[model samples]
Target: MVEIFGIAVSMDPIWLTLEVAGWTTLILLLLGTPLAWWMARLQSSSKIVLEALVALPLVLPPTVLGFYLLIILNPNGYVTEFLRLFGFEGQLTFSKTGLIVGSVFYSLPFAVQPLMHAFEAVPQKLLDAAATMRANAFDRFFTIAMPLSQRGFLVAATLTFAHTIGEFGVVLMLGGNVPGETRMVSIDIFDHVESLEYDQAHLLSAMMLIFSLCVLMLVYALNRRFGVKVG
Candidate 1:
């Protein structure tokens, strides 16, 4: 078992997992909400394709996803090449930023699906009523659709955070387990397993399992409580 500053670093995995999870959730909320709302309201024939694309990460192997990310974000790759045109070096792979981007994609379905369902549940009559009251699109979203779908937002945030916490393949492929930078709990657990530190692995694994359960329970409880409130 590793020790950091006199504390069992194995136990520290919880904190590390929570930190990444929290950030990943925030990113999803900030970005996914608009996308979900758009998807929910869209009547276009392309909506199905777009939603499938959003859900692609769930089915794609993390290693395959990571490999493509590597190709796109490498020092000499598309993103970096674009940056190079502006006299900047954008090194995304094997970095903290890369880990975050990969986590967002990895957990996107969990975030988008719930929000989409929530938005879908909003009665079109409510939006029409808002429009009759001279409410703009933004006003309708904020005052009508969003408030009604708050429970789904809560569930999405919790699930996305929890799911990102356990991400291993994408993080390993993109971040390469660099300590204190991109080496998160899942990677740490893998390292421990490789080193044959069974006890450490057990401790970390147990902590993650417990944390995930708690988060999921919280989601269900909150959704149930507020669901009643909404009703």
Candidate 2:
């Protein structure tokens, strides 16, 4: 819905942003937690290679990542080829699902690194003691490691969600500016600014700034309250 007389407003971008952010955070939580655990306990040289791949997005420019992702997600590329086997007939680009995939990769390190460090911080003696009691690796991980790494989960979830909201380049490149579809808050703000609609841009940008600040503050506060050091 477009507002001409400054009367009505639409919530499409907000909803899309939330939908992608929520699902991206959830996927990272489910995927990143175990990967972080594996990385934490890995002693082999291959671990370095895997860690580098996971962390590469952190240093890589968003446009660069988006460019490669767009290639892979193209109709003739690996992602679509694989999905075709499962009967999914559609393009990933300019869609909400594509945005989720891109966001997951772009925001991967934000979820993994914190949890990796947290998992690494778990005392080895704890595992040793659990082993002495015949506790399986699964048992020990759930009963000991995960319980102690609550701070990492909190930090990872918070950071990923916030980071996904602020993502502009990856979203723009991978998802494009399709309203009621992939056009998120960040992209909307960009469009507004490009068209010199400063008022609308400011309104959305301020909300993003405040939301990000609050998320970070909550992370620090929660960590402090639980005496959980994320570093």
Candidate 3:
């Protein structure tokens, strides 16, 4: 029930936005890490195809992605049907969970690319030395690569979370603007504009701009400090 610039805006949208972004970032870290590791080491034609698919969302229009997701995630869509076989009883469409799924897909490239760079930046000689010591892949990844790639982790997480905040069309298509559920700040801003609530729109827009700037600044500051420590 908080008012921004005298335009009433619910905190629910803010919380939901964070919830979706949080889930998206968490999932990206868990899944994108191993995928990025494998991508860094891969050297094959299929790697090119996989990379293209991962990067598609970066270049593709949000509406295009949202449209396809809507089809695929509908209650009777193939994906839902597959889930139903495992005791699922709900549709992904129009739900906060749907927003998270869409956000993860939309932000996949941001997470993966940073992590791939980080993983690849690990010195080959160090890995080779570890191999000579009979250190397995798991051990090397945890003990060597992970430590050296902290910057990449930070970059990936920051980029993914920020990108999720800017999502609009995908969430709109998949989750609508349902309050206390799937509504995000971006959608709220849109609702304000559509309702001719310019004051609210301006406030939300300025807040997002400031928040994004702060996130970028923090990332740069942390990266600088980490680099000094590494050097």
Best by TM-score: 3
Report the poorest 10 consecutive residues by lDDT, candidate 2.
Answer: 1-10
Instruction: For residues 1-231, write the lDDT of model 1, one tens digit per residue.
Output: 467444366445456567778888999999999999999999999999999999999999999988888887888777878877888754778877778888998999999999999999999998999999999999999999999999999999888988998898898898897777788898888898899877777777887889888988999899889888873
Looking at model 1, the pairs that clash are: none
- What digit string (tens of lDDT, one per residue) describes model 2 on residues 1-231? 666357234578988999999999999999999999999999999999999999999889999999988998987888798999999988898888899999999999999998998899999999999999999999999999998899889889999999998898899889999989999998888888898878788778777889989998998998797663432
Give the per-residue lDDT digits (tens) of candidate 3, residues 51-118. Answer: 99999999999999999999989888889999989998877999987889999999999999989988
lDDT of each: 0.86, 0.90, 0.90
RMSD of 2: 2.4
For each candidate in turn, the TM-score is 0.91, 0.93, 0.95
